[model samples]
Target: MNTVKINWPNKKSSNCSPGVDWLKAAYDADIEIPTGCLGGSCGACEIEVNGEVVRACIATVPDKKELNVEFFSDPYW
Candidate 1:
Protein backbone atom coordinates (compact mmCIF):
# COMPACT_ATOMS: atom_id res chain seq x y z
CA MET A 1 0.00 0.00 0.00
CA ASN A 2 1.39 3.32 -1.00
CA THR A 3 1.47 5.90 1.74
CA VAL A 4 2.13 9.62 1.80
CA LYS A 5 3.32 11.35 4.90
CA ILE A 6 2.05 14.82 5.61
CA ASN A 7 4.16 17.29 7.52
CA TRP A 8 2.11 20.03 9.03
CA PRO A 9 3.53 23.52 9.37
CA ASN A 10 3.56 23.06 13.12
CA LYS A 11 5.92 20.11 12.62
CA LYS A 12 3.24 17.49 13.07
CA SER A 13 3.48 14.24 11.22
CA SER A 14 0.47 12.62 9.61
CA ASN A 15 0.16 9.58 7.47
CA CYS A 16 -2.16 9.10 4.55
CA SER A 17 -2.72 5.41 4.34
CA PRO A 18 -3.29 3.52 1.15
CA GLY A 19 -6.98 3.06 1.74
CA VAL A 20 -7.55 5.93 4.13
CA ASP A 21 -8.47 9.15 2.42
CA TRP A 22 -6.26 12.14 3.19
CA LEU A 23 -8.80 14.82 4.03
CA LYS A 24 -11.00 12.48 6.02
CA ALA A 25 -8.04 10.97 7.79
CA ALA A 26 -6.67 14.36 8.77
CA TYR A 27 -10.04 15.45 10.09
CA ASP A 28 -10.48 12.17 11.95
CA ALA A 29 -7.03 12.57 13.45
CA ASP A 30 -8.18 15.92 14.80
CA ILE A 31 -5.49 17.73 12.83
CA GLU A 32 -8.17 20.28 12.07
CA ILE A 33 -8.08 21.98 8.65
CA PRO A 34 -10.71 24.39 7.51
CA THR A 35 -13.80 23.01 5.86
CA GLY A 36 -17.05 24.73 5.05
CA CYS A 37 -18.61 21.60 3.57
CA LEU A 38 -17.40 18.04 3.45
CA GLY A 39 -18.70 17.76 -0.07
CA GLY A 40 -15.69 19.34 -1.84
CA SER A 41 -17.90 21.77 -3.67
CA CYS A 42 -17.18 24.94 -1.75
CA GLY A 43 -13.42 24.73 -2.12
CA ALA A 44 -12.83 26.34 1.25
CA CYS A 45 -10.23 23.91 2.46
CA GLU A 46 -7.51 24.76 0.04
CA ILE A 47 -3.96 23.55 0.60
CA GLU A 48 -0.54 23.68 -0.90
CA VAL A 49 0.49 20.22 -1.91
CA ASN A 50 4.17 20.10 -2.80
CA GLY A 51 4.13 23.83 -3.42
CA GLU A 52 1.09 23.68 -5.67
CA VAL A 53 -2.12 25.14 -4.36
CA VAL A 54 -5.01 22.71 -4.40
CA ARG A 55 -8.45 22.41 -2.96
CA ALA A 56 -7.94 19.79 -0.31
CA CYS A 57 -11.60 19.14 0.30
CA ILE A 58 -11.90 17.94 -3.29
CA ALA A 59 -8.41 16.71 -3.99
CA THR A 60 -7.77 13.03 -3.59
CA VAL A 61 -4.79 11.67 -1.76
CA PRO A 62 -2.48 10.65 -4.54
CA ASP A 63 -0.02 7.88 -3.93
CA LYS A 64 3.33 9.25 -2.81
CA LYS A 65 1.96 12.74 -3.04
CA GLU A 66 3.79 14.72 -0.43
CA LEU A 67 1.66 17.42 1.10
CA ASN A 68 2.51 20.23 3.46
CA VAL A 69 -0.79 20.75 5.26
CA GLU A 70 0.17 24.16 6.57
CA PHE A 71 -1.65 26.52 4.28
CA PHE A 72 -4.82 25.52 6.04
CA SER A 73 -3.64 27.47 9.04
CA ASP A 74 -2.20 30.34 7.00
CA PRO A 75 -4.69 31.15 4.28
CA TYR A 76 -3.58 34.51 2.98
CA TRP A 77 -2.01 33.99 -0.40
Candidate 2:
Protein backbone atom coordinates (compact mmCIF):
# COMPACT_ATOMS: atom_id res chain seq x y z
CA MET A 1 0.00 0.00 0.00
CA ASN A 2 1.12 3.53 -0.67
CA THR A 3 1.80 5.88 2.24
CA VAL A 4 2.21 9.56 2.90
CA LYS A 5 4.40 11.46 5.27
CA ILE A 6 2.68 13.84 7.70
CA ASN A 7 4.82 16.57 9.15
CA TRP A 8 3.44 17.96 12.37
CA PRO A 9 4.15 21.37 13.83
CA ASN A 10 6.35 19.89 16.54
CA LYS A 11 8.81 18.65 13.90
CA LYS A 12 7.54 15.13 14.40
CA SER A 13 6.42 13.03 11.45
CA SER A 14 4.45 9.87 10.72
CA ASN A 15 3.68 7.67 7.79
CA CYS A 16 0.14 6.66 6.97
CA SER A 17 -1.83 5.30 4.12
CA PRO A 18 -4.00 7.47 1.95
CA GLY A 19 -7.53 8.01 3.21
CA VAL A 20 -6.52 7.00 6.73
CA ASP A 21 -8.19 8.67 9.67
CA TRP A 22 -6.35 11.92 10.30
CA LEU A 23 -7.11 12.05 14.00
CA LYS A 24 -5.68 8.61 14.53
CA ALA A 25 -2.58 9.52 12.57
CA ALA A 26 -2.10 12.65 14.66
CA TYR A 27 -2.48 10.67 17.83
CA ASP A 28 0.09 8.20 16.59
CA ALA A 29 2.49 11.06 16.05
CA ASP A 30 1.97 12.20 19.65
CA ILE A 31 0.38 15.41 18.38
CA GLU A 32 -2.52 16.72 20.38
CA ILE A 33 -5.30 18.04 18.18
CA PRO A 34 -8.25 19.17 20.26
CA THR A 35 -11.69 18.06 19.23
CA GLY A 36 -15.01 19.18 20.61
CA CYS A 37 -17.30 17.13 18.41
CA LEU A 38 -16.23 14.09 16.46
CA GLY A 39 -19.15 14.61 14.08
CA GLY A 40 -17.59 17.59 12.33
CA SER A 41 -20.20 20.02 13.58
CA CYS A 42 -18.35 21.92 16.32
CA GLY A 43 -15.36 22.82 14.14
CA ALA A 44 -13.11 22.41 17.17
CA CYS A 45 -11.00 19.83 15.44
CA GLU A 46 -10.04 22.12 12.59
CA ILE A 47 -6.53 21.75 11.23
CA GLU A 48 -4.46 23.00 8.33
CA VAL A 49 -3.42 20.39 5.84
CA ASN A 50 -1.14 21.50 3.05
CA GLY A 51 -2.15 25.10 3.82
CA GLU A 52 -5.85 24.34 3.69
CA VAL A 53 -8.15 24.20 6.70
CA VAL A 54 -10.01 20.92 7.17
CA ARG A 55 -12.00 19.30 9.95
CA ALA A 56 -9.85 16.49 11.22
CA CYS A 57 -12.83 14.63 12.61
CA ILE A 58 -14.34 14.13 9.18
CA ALA A 59 -11.22 14.33 7.06
CA THR A 60 -8.68 11.77 6.08
CA VAL A 61 -5.16 11.84 4.83
CA PRO A 62 -5.05 12.70 1.16
CA ASP A 63 -3.14 10.88 -1.57
CA LYS A 64 -0.36 13.40 -1.47
CA LYS A 65 3.06 12.02 -0.79
CA GLU A 66 3.72 14.57 1.92
CA LEU A 67 1.34 16.55 4.10
CA ASN A 68 2.24 19.48 6.28
CA VAL A 69 -0.23 19.74 9.15
CA GLU A 70 -0.62 22.48 11.68
CA PHE A 71 -3.16 23.10 14.39
CA PHE A 72 -5.79 25.65 13.56
CA SER A 73 -6.32 27.57 16.75
CA ASP A 74 -9.43 29.59 17.40
CA PRO A 75 -9.64 31.95 20.36
CA TYR A 76 -13.35 31.39 20.63
CA TRP A 77 -12.82 27.67 20.99
Candidate 3:
Protein backbone atom coordinates (compact mmCIF):
# COMPACT_ATOMS: atom_id res chain seq x y z
CA MET A 1 0.00 0.00 0.00
CA ASN A 2 1.15 3.48 -0.80
CA THR A 3 1.33 6.25 1.73
CA VAL A 4 0.08 9.80 1.45
CA LYS A 5 2.03 12.78 2.68
CA ILE A 6 -0.10 14.95 4.92
CA ASN A 7 0.76 18.57 5.69
CA TRP A 8 -1.08 19.51 8.82
CA PRO A 9 -2.12 22.99 9.88
CA ASN A 10 0.20 22.78 12.86
CA LYS A 11 3.13 22.60 10.45
CA LYS A 12 3.57 18.95 11.24
CA SER A 13 3.70 16.28 8.56
CA SER A 14 2.90 12.63 8.46
CA ASN A 15 3.01 9.95 5.84
CA CYS A 16 0.01 7.73 6.35
CA SER A 17 -1.54 4.90 4.46
CA PRO A 18 -4.76 5.49 2.64
CA GLY A 19 -8.02 4.68 4.41
CA VAL A 20 -6.63 5.70 7.81
CA ASP A 21 -8.86 7.75 10.03
CA TRP A 22 -8.09 11.45 10.23
CA LEU A 23 -8.00 11.39 14.00
CA LYS A 24 -5.50 8.56 14.01
CA ALA A 25 -3.35 10.29 11.48
CA ALA A 26 -3.37 13.46 13.52
CA TYR A 27 -2.57 11.53 16.65
CA ASP A 28 0.37 9.85 14.97
CA ALA A 29 1.66 13.23 14.00
CA ASP A 30 1.20 14.52 17.52
CA ILE A 31 -1.34 17.07 16.37
CA GLU A 32 -4.61 17.79 18.03
CA ILE A 33 -7.75 18.28 16.00
CA PRO A 34 -10.49 19.58 18.24
CA THR A 35 -13.67 17.53 18.31
CA GLY A 36 -17.01 18.13 19.93
CA CYS A 37 -18.43 14.81 18.83
CA LEU A 38 -16.88 11.59 17.65
CA GLY A 39 -19.45 11.41 14.88
CA GLY A 40 -19.96 13.85 12.02
CA SER A 41 -22.82 15.71 13.64
CA CYS A 42 -20.81 18.70 14.84
CA GLY A 43 -18.47 20.92 12.83
CA ALA A 44 -15.91 21.30 15.59
CA CYS A 45 -13.64 18.77 13.97
CA GLU A 46 -13.94 20.33 10.54
CA ILE A 47 -10.70 20.61 8.57
CA GLU A 48 -9.67 21.65 5.13
CA VAL A 49 -7.95 18.94 3.14
CA ASN A 50 -6.43 20.02 -0.11
CA GLY A 51 -8.69 23.02 0.00
CA GLU A 52 -11.76 20.88 0.61
CA VAL A 53 -13.59 21.09 3.91
CA VAL A 54 -14.34 17.82 5.70
CA ARG A 55 -15.17 16.70 9.20
CA ALA A 56 -12.12 14.95 10.61
CA CYS A 57 -14.22 12.81 12.89
CA ILE A 58 -15.87 11.03 10.00
CA ALA A 59 -13.25 11.44 7.33
CA THR A 60 -10.25 9.36 6.36
CA VAL A 61 -6.96 10.11 4.81
CA PRO A 62 -7.70 10.08 1.13
CA ASP A 63 -5.46 8.42 -1.44
CA LYS A 64 -3.28 11.13 -2.78
CA LYS A 65 0.40 11.86 -3.26
CA GLU A 66 0.27 14.86 -0.96
CA LEU A 67 -2.48 16.59 1.00
CA ASN A 68 -2.46 20.02 2.58
CA VAL A 69 -4.63 20.34 5.65
CA GLU A 70 -5.85 23.44 7.41
CA PHE A 71 -8.01 23.80 10.49
CA PHE A 72 -11.37 25.46 10.10
CA SER A 73 -11.35 28.41 12.42
CA ASP A 74 -14.60 29.80 13.75
CA PRO A 75 -14.06 33.34 14.98
CA TYR A 76 -17.13 33.14 17.17
CA TRP A 77 -16.49 29.69 18.54
Please report the candidate that would top lDDT against the real structure: 3
TM-score rank, highest first?
3, 2, 1
Comparing 2 and 3 on TM-score, the stronger one: 3
| Clashes (N, CA, C under 3 Å) per candidate | 0, 0, 0
lDDT of 1 by residue, 1-77 (tens): 77778777668777777545557867755676678886777767777767777676667766675656657444453
Question: Please, what is the TM-score per model?
Answer: 0.69, 0.91, 0.92
CA lDDT of each prediction against the hidden true structure: 0.68, 0.90, 0.92
Residue 12, candidate 1: alpha-carbon lDDT: 79
Write model 3 residue lDDT over 1-77, tens digit each, in one string: 99999998778788999999999999999999999979899899999998888999999999999999999876887
C-alpha RMSD (angstroms) for model 2: 1.2
Ordering by lDDT:
3, 2, 1
User: Model 3: runs farther than 4 Å from truth?
Assistant: none
Residue 5 in model 3: shift from native, Å?
0.3
- Per-residue lDDT for 67 in model 1? 58
